[model samples]
Target: MARAHRREALLAAVLTGALTALALWRVQPGGSGYPVPETPEVCLRQFREAILQGDPERIRNLLSEEMHPHQDRLVREQQPRLTQTLSWVIVQTRQSGQSALVLVHEMHRDGWIYPVEYELLYREPAWQISRISYLPPEKASIAPGTHVREAPWGQELSAPPEPSRTEGPDPEDTP
Candidate 1:
């Protein structure tokens, strides 16, 4: 029947279109575009989105080898806090030859700033977040006892905020 053939063709077209769309959606880079930006502004924007979404996959895509290994740990750290409504406003951004630092004023659902630093490293075509140091950090391995937290990105990402402090002269003060 001609009418039956037409209906079948229409159904097939619809199915094909749906499949194509779904594939595009799934394979799309960062769900924004493939190959996330290495620039400081885009890096911070994507970082905020990844944190808010708590999507580890998105976060991983943005990182290079320097920051990639700790994706799981970063995901675990961010997931619990993702439930809370929050916002990130960039306070400042500093970039050297291959590294960048973004000062983000994270705010609660009520819009009060939660002070923290988000560090980014540019690795050609992408910018990877290297550290997140909460201002006035409590004594911890990941966070310094001072008002500023500074450490190697790889070592700093995994430790808890209140990491145990070994009793001795602080390593940071040596220099």
Candidate 2:
């Protein structure tokens, strides 16, 4: 009877150990989390590395099919330009739920800096890129006293003259 009881206790302990290990494994980052990054920082780091390395294949896999073509074109078109004229650096990442927006700074060869924003969408159990947009740098407008004359093929030449202020709002504004 004692021997049988000992055997039963050993079996129970083995079962409990197995169950605990299984639970722990399921709760691990990638095991349960879809497209887990190990950590959020890792995700952003990987993104920057992918860009600097010019690995479009890795980038493409991270985007939806609809978004893939656009990024592919961007890499194909911009990479040469990027290699020649700019260096990309990730400035920051803003993440909400599974989506993230990565802000990148492009340091131009001429010492100009431009900010570009990348919209990342996480879906289908993975993180995929959705859209990318360029944000132009701010510049001061011409001074009020500065002479600004329109030349041929300029804004004034291409567009018809606007009605005088006395004429009131345009037709499009009426709606």
Candidate 3:
């Protein structure tokens, strides 16, 4: 019975020690608890943080050279939330080998969630941002009483606002 008690105490002590180590790992100044952002998901987390803080330089660093031209575009798009306090959330992250797609949503102060997807590639040193795609608003379906006034791709025509019942009085009715 004494031998069994000693074995149990040893087992408990080992488990407690392991848990303690894990718990304190991240607290260490230079700990390896969380590795450097090597994976796409990890890189994306950093990118999202940069976006939330409006750190254009950080965001640019995360992007690939080919995406440098788009830096201004991204900064411009995020300008709306600069004035208001906003929170960003990563909805989902999908990765395969060196490529990944991270779905993010920025919650506006007015409670609107705008979804954006980040395409990433694991470059030599780390994963880099390839592109950021914003989801477009859903098109309205043509219902019995509904009207399809808006055109695709946000284009506006100068023709007219009113809906016409006949298209030039039909082709056969022309004299």
Best by lDDT: 3
lDDT of 2: 0.62
Score each candidate by Cα lDDT. Answer: 0.66, 0.62, 0.68
Consecutive 10-residue window with the lowest summed lDDT within model 2: 26-35
lDDT of 3 by residue, 72-140 (tens): 887677665534426566789998888899887665555456677889888766678898888852222
Q: Tell me the spans in candidate 1 whose CA falls farther than 4 Å from its real position.
A: 1-35, 109-112, 137-175
Could you tell me how far off, in angstroms, the CA of residue 48 lies in candidate 2 after the best superposition? 4.9
lDDT tens digits by residue: candidate 2, 22-87: 666522223432234443445545545566688666655555578765775767755654664445
Better of 1 and 3 by TM-score: 1
Highest TM-score: which candidate? 1
Clashing residue pairs in candidate 2, if any? none
Per residue, candidate 1 scores C-alpha lDDT tens digits across 1-175 of 9999999999999999999987665322446454456487786677657867776677877665667778787777665544443555677888888888877665544434556677777765567777767774222233222244554456446555787899999999998
- Model 2: per-residue Cα lDDT at residue 139: 31
